[model samples]
Target: MRRFYAILVAAGLVYMLFMFLGTIVPYGKADVADRVSAHFLAKDVNSISPTKWVEGDKQVPHSERVYGRKGFEDGSANVVTSIVVNYRSFDTLGEVTVLFASAVGVGLILGGTRRMKYGRKPNFILRVSTGILLPLIILFGIYIFVHGHLTPGGGFPGGTIIAAAVLLLYLSNEEFSLNMIVSKSLEGSMGSLYVIFGLIGLAAGGAFLFNFLPNGVVGSLFSAGVVPLVYMTIGLKVGSELSGVVAEIHEEREG
Candidate 1:
């Protein structure tokens, strides 16, 4: 009976949609006059035409302007990085704050008085392999964040990758533990560095996160003014925060 009612409701909605469209469109075969009327109704009834859509002469898009000027102005090969770190940096900071709050919330909720040792120790082979792989994974994460201004990936994904490497260690070694104090400290420090950079921009250039520094040669490692610096700070902050989140969950599970 419920399904029948739902079907009826869906059918009624479809019927209403078709009826509304029917009112806007002529019902039957049309003469030249009807065809003209229909054309005007569909094309001009909206009170604007393609020619009049914009207020001025067909303008070049802002993105196009950015692309042409990015080399000198932003010094980043990757356009997305320039936008995120230089154009919309405040939003990125807000995102970091939200992630930090979430991590803290998880810790408060899951942390308890008792110590936890849940998973059994893995074999020697697994342990040794993980130990070997861990450094490489961390290095890759660092590379990803460092080259964010020149490449496809950025701080957020690179940081998550680093956290995953840490998680792999936790899974392989039962005794492996994340020091909450150290992780939190690193997270806090990175966050502070990000803010300090913004403050420096404000003091030096009169705007928060202003590109006060020189934009080096495009495609160079040290280019992109504050973009790489901001991304690196974000990478450290995200990596530590996510690692702490996983640690909290692991502790709760083991306890």
Candidate 2:
């Protein structure tokens, strides 16, 4: 019986090795960088021309219009930013929902068994320092999300900053427990509201995630109709999810 089990394990390992080698055996002697450059150069420059797409669509694909070029059009100056907050805003909303779900899963797996608290209480020096730094971190996060349409930062980066602040709070304040109910509830509510708003846009404008509000003058604070709003929702959802994950990990470790 022992020999049979060993033989089976060896056979499985051999099979996996063959499968791994098979994937690499078919590669041709081609320069990967050259292939990438060729693909990049072959693209229709006129269609993806930054100036044309960002300034105003003379002739560009609808996918690019809705999901690619909002940065230039809205003066955000970052293509990825425009994509997340404006063009593919609905996808971002979905991503937040996935984050929320992951947080819940982590909580259920780790938080259910027992609740334990660890780490030392913060000394006076640490407490004072955190109190000073917390507000600044939060302010910077807000700035990043708000300027997403006109600058380099956006929801994900900003949300991460806010999450860091929450972690600091957990570390510095030993007695305080993260309010899981409030955090998860807020995440769910905001994520749902984001989707509902997108659906409303679809119903009214005949396009999902359509910028129902006036496009406004390009490059201005109020310009990218729904971009900032979507970004704010994303930031909130991301912050909550990340904080929840951290809390779950802390609980697991304590247990």
lDDT of each: 0.75, 0.67
Worst 10 residues of 2 by lDDT: 36-45
lDDT (tens digit, per residue) of candidate 1 on 164-211: 998888888787788888999899989878877876776576556677
Off by over 4 Å in 1: 1-73, 113-115, 123-125, 253-255
Q: Clashing residue pairs, candidate 1?
A: none
**Candidate 2 lDDT over residue span 1-255, tens digit each:** 978855754664465456446545355765664442332232332344453222233555534543444322343445566666665665776777677777778877877433346655577787789999999999998889888877888888888898899888877777656888898887777776676566656556655565677665445788677787877877887887788887777675432
lDDT of 1 at 225: 89
- The weakest ten consecutive residues by lDDT in model 1 span 39-48
Q: Which parts of model 2 have CA positions greater than 4 angstroms off?
A: 1-75, 112-115, 252-255
lDDT for model 1: 0.75
Q: Each prediction's TM-score against the native? A: 0.70, 0.67
